[model samples]
Target: MTSASSAGPRRVVVVRHAETVDNAARIWQGHKDTELSERGRAQVQAAAPHLAAYAPSLIVSSDLRRAAATAEAIAGLTGLEVRLDPRLREVHVGEWQGLHADEVRERYPEVVAALDRGEDAPRGVTGETMAQVAHRAGTALREISDELEAGETAVVVAHGVSARVAVSDLVGLDQDVSDAVFRGLGNCHWIELVEAGKSYSEATRWRISGWNLGPWNV
Candidate 1:
């Protein structure tokens, strides 16, 4: 297993896309193609310099508008082509796609219960399962790690849920640690991953190479 500590500076930077208007409204933006809010754009502006510090060789993000826009900004800063990868899309919430937490609890308590059951709940409205999201995200991550050619660093911009899940899979995190990875990452926050030997490791292994250089509170 390649340890990050032994890999020098070859790293992966996991970044949460900038916030959207829906985030400000507390609405579920899963799979929504909402544009970045003005604040979201500014957040990305603030974060660009920090991200450019990586001098990333490649930048990938969800094809959805919010994520795509965020990726575009970083691409501009680093001059790396922004590649839209569908596997990095946000987990589809189906019926709960646009609903707030209170609305979900009030109208679909059963669906929420299913979500808490440690499995992907069926799309009460039209959603994909967490299991499905994990499958695609895990595959994409592995491909980036094992297939990256000539690049010393690659950056992936993703959503909240899948970001935690992907990192959990990479680091073999226990459930609690995996679940709480979100605590350290905020909107437009950057987490650095160091690959040791051929094995993978989490951002905790590195210094705050870059951080929540955004205006939003995550």
Candidate 2:
């Protein structure tokens, strides 16, 4: 999209939730709610201060507990109430939920093969596509951006996949391009984006100010 003037928030921070019990155990957690691990609580404590340094006015997050917990940490630090939204949740894996990664690889080798070949395969045969994920996640992000004033900032806490997909949408990059360019979103890590356009649309754009920042380097 074109880089015009910002009509909404000036800056935005996209954060991935910290480690969950499922995440630690390599379980496939798409739309399957799980609690944060002990390490995740500590991670939240560590990352919250860095996020608070931005002085963001709002904190939005997925309704899932994993993301909610992370958002709560920032809220505690910044005194901003957490806004829960289901749109920010992770991609639905259909039957893949509760299954381990290895199980998925074994049971859905065809779908996994397609995805591994860079094809946009539907997750778990009956789940949403990457495009669908981008659509819902992008819409949520746009709404959040629209709610802010020019000088305001907001933190969006979501899952790893949705976070990157939303960035690709806002930055006008192809999903495949972002899929290849962006690496892992480590637990409690975040990316900062500066709004460079008025409103969120095909003629608007955002600049990535920082990426993959965590407590140590934040």
> Whose TM-score is greatest here?
2
C-alpha lDDT of candidate 2 relative to the true structure: 0.87
Say which candidate scores most in lDDT. Answer: 2
Candidate 1's TM-score reads 0.81
Candidate 2's displacement at residue 41, Å, is 0.7
Segments of candidate 2 deviating more than 4 angstroms: 1-9, 197-204
lDDT of 2 by residue, 1-218 (tens): 22334345478899999999999999989999899999999999999998988898899999999999899999998888999999999998888889999999999999999999988788988888889999999899988877767668899999999998987787678999777888868999998988664444545457787889998876
User: How far off is residue 132 in model 2, in Å?
Assistant: 0.4
**Which ten-residue region of model 2 has the weakest summed lDDT?**
1-10
Q: Going through the candidates in order, what is the number of backbone clashes in each? A: 12, 4
Q: How does each model score on lDDT? A: 0.71, 0.87
